[model samples]
Target chain A: MTVAPMLSVSGLAVDYQLSSGALFRKHRSLNAVADVSFDIAPGETLGLVGESGSGKTTVGRAVLRRISAAKGTIVFDGEDITRLKGERLRRLRSRMQIVLQDPYTSLNPRMTVADIIAEPLIVHGLASSAEETRVVVAELLERVGLPRDAADRYPHSFSGGQRQRIGIARALALKPSLIVADEPVSALDVSVRAQVVNLMQDLQRDLDISYLFIAHDLAIVRHISHRVAIMYAGRIVEIAPRAAIYNRPIHPYTEALLSAVPIANPKLQRVRRRIVHPGEAVDIANPPSGCRFHPRCPLATERCRNEAPHLLRKAAEHFAACWNRDA
Target chain B: MTSPLLEIDNLHVCFDTRAGTVQALRGVSLSLAPGETLGIVGESGSGKSVTAQAVMGLIDVPGRISEGEVRWQGRPLAGRNADRDARPVWGKEITMVFQNPMTSLNPLMTVGSQISEVIELHLGLSRPAARRRAAELLSSVGISGAERRLDQYPHEFSGGMRQRVMIAMGIACEPKLLIADEPTTALDVTIQAQILELMAELQEKMGLAIVLITHDLGIVAGLCHRVAVMYAGQIVETGLVDAIFENPLHPYTQGLIRSTPGLDAEEERLTAIEGAPPGLLQPPAGCSFLPRCPIGDKGCEAPQAMRIFETGMVACRKAGVPAWSEAL
Candidate 1:
C-alpha cells in the first residue's frame, strides 16, 4: 500500500490583471499558469522543466505561497494550502523554502554568511540566543562544504559557486521538508555548477528532503530528480520516472525537448532528426486551443487540432497529457 | 578548398591588467565552413566568448588581439584591432546576438527601428525598404503580428520574445556569418529548445555560417557540426561532435562530460574536477588543465602542444586520442 503524496497541486491557476482598456473597461486577466496539476512523493525530487513563459517558476512560487494561487488546491502534508492564511500560512512558509536562480542577487551583499543563514532561524524563532543562532548557521554553512571561517564574509566575497552554497545553507536553515529550487545553477560557471548540484544531492540524501527542482537544464535535472515533469504554455504535459522520462519520453513535446538537447556522441548528434523549433513568441497569452503545442509538434494530427487532451495515467505510474502516448 | 567562412590562425588575446597581461586566448585556431554551425564549448572565461569578441572585432581595451589573424571570406577583416571604445563590427558582414537581450537592445528605440538600423547601415537600404525588411525579419523569427510588435519596446516583450527580437536583429541584413554568444543560456529548457531550433532552421534558410559559443557540451553534441573545446583561452579539443563526445582526449572535456547529469548511468557520486579551473593569470605549467586533470599524475608533466587525430584533436602530454576500437 502506497502512502498519499506529500504535496499535490491540482488545477492550479494564476492570472495577473492588465491595465484598463478604456474608461470603464473590465479588467482582463492574463493567465500565467493554467489548470496545472502534479504530485510530489515524500522525499522525492520533482524536476519541473519548461521554457521561460511556461510558468514552471510560477507553479513553484505558488506552491511555496510566495505568490497567490488564483485557483486550485495545494495540499502539503495532507493539508490544503490554497486558502490557508494568517499564522497557519506563515507556518506553512517555514516548512517550504525557495533557493533562487541568481545566487549573487538572492543574497544580500551587506549580510555576512552567518547573518544570512541565521536570519531564517531567527525569523522562524527556531533559535533562542545569538550564540545558538551562530552555532546553527555555522553548521549549515559546513553542511554545504564551506569552511567555518566563510561565516563572517559578505556575499560579495564569495564566488558564484560559493554564493550558491550560502543560498543552500539559508534554504536548509528551516529544515524544510520541501524546497523550491528555481534555476539554482543557471547563473554559475559550468564546472562550478557540478559542485553545487552535488552538494544539494548530498543534502537531500542526508535530510530526506523533497525538492521542486525547476530549471531549463535537462541534464542537471536528470541527474538529481526522482521524477520529471515537462511543462509548456503554463501546464504540465508529461510526468514520469527520471529514467522513463529521459530514455523513453511519452509526449511529443518531451521527445522534441529531448531531441533538441545536443548529445556528446558525434555520430548520434549528426544522425538525430531535429524537431525544428517554432519561433519564440507565438502569443501564449491566448494560447491555441485543442493542443497548446500543436503549432510546433512535428507529429501533430487533425485530432490534435480540435481536442485538448487531459493528463491521464498511461502506465502504472506514468502520466501524460497527449493524444499518442503509445506512439 | 573554397575559402572557409572564417579563419583564426595562432590567435592570442590579452588584457593589460594591473597585475600583468592576462592571456585569454592562446594560439586558438578554427575554420568555419559556409552555412555551418561551429560550437565552441568551454567553461566561463574559457575564451569561447573571447573568440567571438575577437572575430567581431569588439574586444575591449586594455584587452587587445595581441597576436594572430582573423580572416573573413579570404580577406582580413578591416579592423584587425578593436578600438578601446568603438562598436567596430556593427551591422556589417558579421553580426552578433548577445546572451542578454534587454541590455543588448535599445530600450528607448522601437524594435522595428532597431532592426531596420542594421539593414539601413549594413546593406545601405532606403528607410522604407529597411522598415519592410525589419517586419519580414520579425515575422520570420516567429514574432507574429509583426507589424504591431515592430513598434514595441524591449521592455514590452517577454524574455523569449526579446530574444526573438535579438535574433531578428542579428539576421536582419542576412549577414554572411552570425556569432551567437550563449543565445539560449538565459532561457528555459523548452524555450531554449525552441530558440535553438529556430537558429538551426534560420541557418539553413539563410545559408549563414554560425559561431555558437556555449559551455554546455550537450549543445555541441546536437546542434554543432564541429566543436572546439576551449580551456585557459586555448582550444584544448577540436573535432567533429561525435568524435569529441565519444572519445574526449582532453582531461577538461572528460571532466565536463562526467559532471553533466544524464541517463547513461546512475551516478551515485558525481566525479567533480578537482580544484578550480586554473586562473588565466597563472594557469598551469605544461597542460592548462593539469591542476584539475582527473587522470593526471606525474605522467602529464611534459608540455604538449595540440595535435590532430583522425577526426579530432587534443592538447595533452600523457593522453593519446582514444582509438576507434576503444570507443566501442
Candidate 2:
C-alpha cells in the first residue's frame, strides 16, 4: 500500500492590494501567485525555483497560511486545511515551519540562543518543563554542529553560517514534518553554505522530514531537491524530477534558466550555449494576458499568445505548460 | 607583451581596533595586464574586497596599508606624504563597481546626471556634451531608449538596469582597469548572465582590464582568464582558470570546487569544509587554514609562502600530494 504525500496544494492563487494608489480611488491588486499546484512526498524535497516576483515565496507563504490565498485549496496530511482557523491553524503550525531567507534579520538579536531554540517548544507546549526544554535545546545545538556552551550567547556574537544553524535548530524544535526553507543559504558565504546544506540533508535523513526548498539559485536547488517546480510570473511553468529538469527540460523558461546557470567546469563552460531572452523583466503588476511567459518566450507563437497552456504530461512523472513543447 | 596595467607587490593591510589589530590582508600580490580579466575567489573575510579598495586608494582610517606598494604603469602611487590630497588615478585610470546597485547609485540624482557627472569631472566636458556622452554610454551598456531613461532616477530603473548604469559610470572616462566586486550577485540568474555578457562584450570592444572579485567559482570559470584563491586574507592559489579548476593544488581550492553544487552533475553529498574561518583579531602563528584543512598537520604551525608549481602557485605544505588525489 502507498502512503499519501505530506503536503498537496492545488490551484493556489494569491493577490496583494497595491499600497501606492489613492485610498478614495479604485483598489488595485497585484497577482502575486496565479494558479499553481504541486505535492511533496514524505521525506522528499520539492524545490520551487523562480526569479523575483515569480510568486515562489508567495506559494510557500500561502501554504503556511501566513498569506491568504485568493483561490485554491491546501491539503496537509490527507486533511483539507485551506480555511483552517484559530485552534486548528495553531495546531497545524507545529507540523509546518519556515526558515527565512536572511539569517541576520530572520532571528531576534536580543534573544539568547537557548531561548531562540526553545521558543517553538514553549509556544507549542511540547516540553514538559523548563529543564526539559534546556535539554532539548542542547541536543538541538549539537545536532546543528554548534557547541553546547553556545546556548548562552546571543545571536550577534555568532557568524552568518552559525546563526543560520541556530535558525534551523529553532525550526526543528517542534519536530515539524514539513519545513519551508526560503533561500536559507543565499545570505551565507560560499564556503559555509555547503556546511548548512549538508546539515539540512543530514537532518532530513535522520528525522525523515519533508522540505519545500524555495530559492532563486538553480544549482543549489538542483543539488538539494528531488523534484523541482519552475515558477514564472506567479505560475508553475514546469514540474519534473530533478534529473529531467536539469538534463531534459521541456519548457522554454526551464531551458533558459538551466542554460543561464554558469557551469563550474571550465571545459563545459566554453562549449555550453547561453539562451538570451530578448525581453525586459516580467512586470508582475501588469502581467501579459494568456500565457504569462509569452512576451519573452523565443518560441512563442500567435496561439501561445492568444491561449494559456495548462500543465500537460510530457514524459513519465514530468509535466510542462508550453504550447510548443515538441518544437 | 605590454607591461601590466596595475601591479601590487607584497600588499599588507591591517585594521586597528580597541581589542586588537585585525590583519585583513597579508602579503597579497597580483598583476592585471591590459584587457586581462583576473578573478579573485574567496568566502567572506577572505580580503577580496580589501584588495579592490586598496587598488582604488579608498582604504580609510582604522584600516591602514601597513606595507608593500601599488604601482600604476610602473610608477608607485602617492604614499603617505603628498602635498595636497590629489588622487589622479582613482576615477580616471582605475574605477570600481560595488555589489549592491540599490545603494551604490545615488537615489536623489537622476541616472543620466550620475553618469554625466563622472564624465564631466574626469574628462572636463561641458554639461551638454557630458549628458550626450552619458546617453551614449547607457546605450552602449545595453539599456534601451537610453535618451529617455537617462532622465529617470535610480528608483525608476530595475536592479539589472541600475547595475548597467553603474558599469557605464565605471567606464565613463575610458578607464584602463575596472574592479567589479560581486557585480552580479544581487541580480537573478538570467539577468546575471546578461550583465556578465555585457561586461565581456565591453571588455572586447574597449580593451578593458577587469579585476572580478566574487565567491562563485562557476563565474570565474566562465569569464576570468586567471584565478586567485584567497583564504584567511592570503592568496592560497593562483593559476589559469582551467588549471585551477582541473588540477587545484591547494586543499582549500579543491574543497571549494567539490563543495559547490554543479548544475551539470549531481552528487549525493557535498565535501564541506569542516570548521569556521579564523578570527582576524590577531594573525595566526601558523597556516590560518590548518584547523579546517583536510590534509593539515602540526608542521603547519609555521608560516608558508607561495611555491611555484608546474601550472601555478600554491601556498600549502602538502599541496600537490597524490593522497589528496583520487578523492574527487
Candidate 3:
C-alpha cells in the first residue's frame, strides 16, 4: 500500500579497468564505488559529500545509468533500471536528467539556447512541431529565471552563472522527476554560486523535483540537501538527516570532514578544535582492510582493523559504519 | 611606534589590453605587521591576486602598478618600472605561493631540486647543504617520507602533497612575509584543512607575516587577524577579523557575508547579491558597488572616500555599524 521512494539504489558498485598497456597484459580493476545504497523520496534532496577520489561522482553517474554498475540494482520510480537497454533505457532516461559541473563546456557552444533546450523534446518526441518546442523552451527558460529572449542567444554570450541557468533549463526541459547534479556550483564564483544555489532550491520547491546533489563543498550541500551521505574510499561511511549529520556525525571520517569546514564566523572559528586526520588518504586501488577510516580514526581499536563494520543504526534515521562509534 | 612590516598605500594597477585599459587595482591599500596575517577577500576579478602579484614584483607585460607605495620594513619598493628586479626583497624577505601548484612547480624538476634551488639562491648554501635543507623543509611542512618523496617529480605527488612542496619552497629562505593567493582553493576541503594547518603552524614557528588572498571568507575568518573586503579592484572595507565579520560596514562586505552559506546556520533561502561584478575594462567612476548596493541613492553618485570608524574603515556613503543585520 505504501508508495516507494522516487529513486532507490542498493549495493551499487562501479569498477574501472585500467589497462597496463602492452600486448598480453592483464588489466587492473579499480573499484571506484562499492556497496553504496540510499533512497530519495519524492521532492527530496540527498547530498553525496566527500573529498576527491571518494567516489562521490561515481555514485551519481551510476544512478543516472551514464556508467554501467558492476554490481547491484538501481530501482527508479518502482522500475528496475539497472539493466535497461536501448529503447527501454532511453525512455527511462527522459524521467531522469543530469547537470554537470562546468557550465562553460557542458553546453554545446554551437547550439542556440532554444535548440539546446528543445533538443530533448524533439528527440523524445514530446513535442509535435517546432513551434511547440519553442513554447516549451521559453517556459523552461523563464522557469529557471532566464529571460525568454535568451532563447535566441548562444551560450557564449551568457556569464558562467547564466550559462548554468541555461544548463538547468536544459535539464528541466525533460521535466524529470530526479536530477543528478554533480558539483553544479563548484566552478562558479562565490557570489554567482549563491545565485545558482538559490535558483536550484527555488526550482526544487516549485517543480517538486528530487536531486542527487554531489559536491565537495559542504556549506552549499548543507544549504540545499535534506539528507546527507558521507562517502570515503568507495564506501558510504555514514547516512543521516541534515541536522544529525552536521551536529552529531558518528563516523570518524564524517567527524573529521565536518570539523575541517571553516565557518565564516570568526568568533566561532577561533574557539573550535579542529580534528586533523594524522594518516594519509585511503588508496582506492588498495583500500585499508576492515573499516576504511580506521587508519585516520582517533578512536580506532584493534577490532576496527581486523573486522569491517556494516551500516548500523545509531539512532532514528541515522546509520554509520564504525566499530568504535561510541568512543 | 614601529612601522608595520609591510604597508601598501593607494595601490593602483592597470593592464593595457587591445580592447581597453583594464584598471585592476584602484587605490587598494593594506598594512601587515610582523607575524600578523592579513586576508584579502574578494570574488574573481576583484584584484585580490593582482595585489599579491604586485607585492612580489611579479607583475609583467601590459600590467603596470600605476600608483602606490609598497614599503618593506619602512623601505619603499614601489613606483619603479616593470623591469626593476627587487631580487633581494623577493625570496629572502618576501615570498609568494600561487594558487595552482601544478603550474607553480616546474614539472621538469624534482620536488627536492625546486626547494633546493630556492635555498641555494636565497640562503647561498652549498648544493649538498641545500639538498639536506630541502628534505628538512619538506618534513617541516608535514609531508611524510619527506626524504624519499623529494626525489619525485611534481607529477608523482598528489595535489595536496605538491602544495606542501610549494610551501616548503616558499619558506626555504625563512622569509619574513609570505603571500599565499588561493593556495588551498584547488584542493578539497579535507586536504585544504591539512594545507591550512601546515601554513598556520609554519607561520607561528617562523613568525611569517602572511597575506592570505582568497575568495572564501571562512578561511579568512579562521586564519587571518585582519581582513580586507575588496570589490571592483578596491578595498571596500578593512578591519580586524572580528569587526569585519561581526559588523561589516560596507554593503559589498555585507552582501558577501550574506551570500555565503554558513556551515553552522541553516537557512531556507540564501540572500544572493542581485547583479554580477562590474567589468574592470571601465572601472566605475563613483562608488564601484553602486550598481549592486542595496541602499544606493543620489548620494552614491559621487565618489565616496574611505570613512574611518572606531573599529575599521569602510568606503561607503551610507555605511554604518551593520544596521542591515536586523533588517535581513
Residue by residue across B1-328, what tens digits does model 1's lDDT show?
A: 5668888888888999998888898888889988888999887778899888888877889988878878776666523543433343445668899999879999999988998888888778999999999999989998889999989889999887899999998887778888999998777555676788789899889898888998777677767888888888888888887776776777777777766766466676665664566678866667777766655668677667777689977887644533212121
Task: Give the worst 10-residue stretch by lDDT in candidate 3 chain A.
Answer: A318-327
TM-score of chain B of each: 0.92, 0.96, 0.95
Candidate number 1, chain A TM-score = 0.95
- Order of the predicted models by TM-score, top scorer first: 2, 3, 1
Residue A121, candidate 3: C-alpha displacement in angstroms: 1.9
Pick the winner on lDDT between candidates 1 and 2.
Answer: 2
Instruction: Give the runs in model 2 whose Cα sits over 4 Å from its true position.
Output: B78-86, B322-328
A108 in model 2: Cα distance from truth in Å?
1.6
* Winning model by DockQ: 2
Give the poorly placed runs of model 3, Cα more than 4 Å off: A1-3, B81-85, B321-328
Global Cα lDDT for candidate 2: 0.89
**Top candidate by TM-score:** 2
Worst 10 residues of 1 chain A by lDDT: A274-283
- Estimate TM-scores for all models: 0.85, 0.97, 0.96
Please tell me how candidate 1 rates in CAPRI terms: acceptable
Clashes of each: 4, 0, 0
**DockQ comparison, 2 vs 3, better candidate:** 2
lDDT value, residue B152 of candidate 3: 93
Model 3 chain B: weakest 10-residue lDDT segment is: B78-87
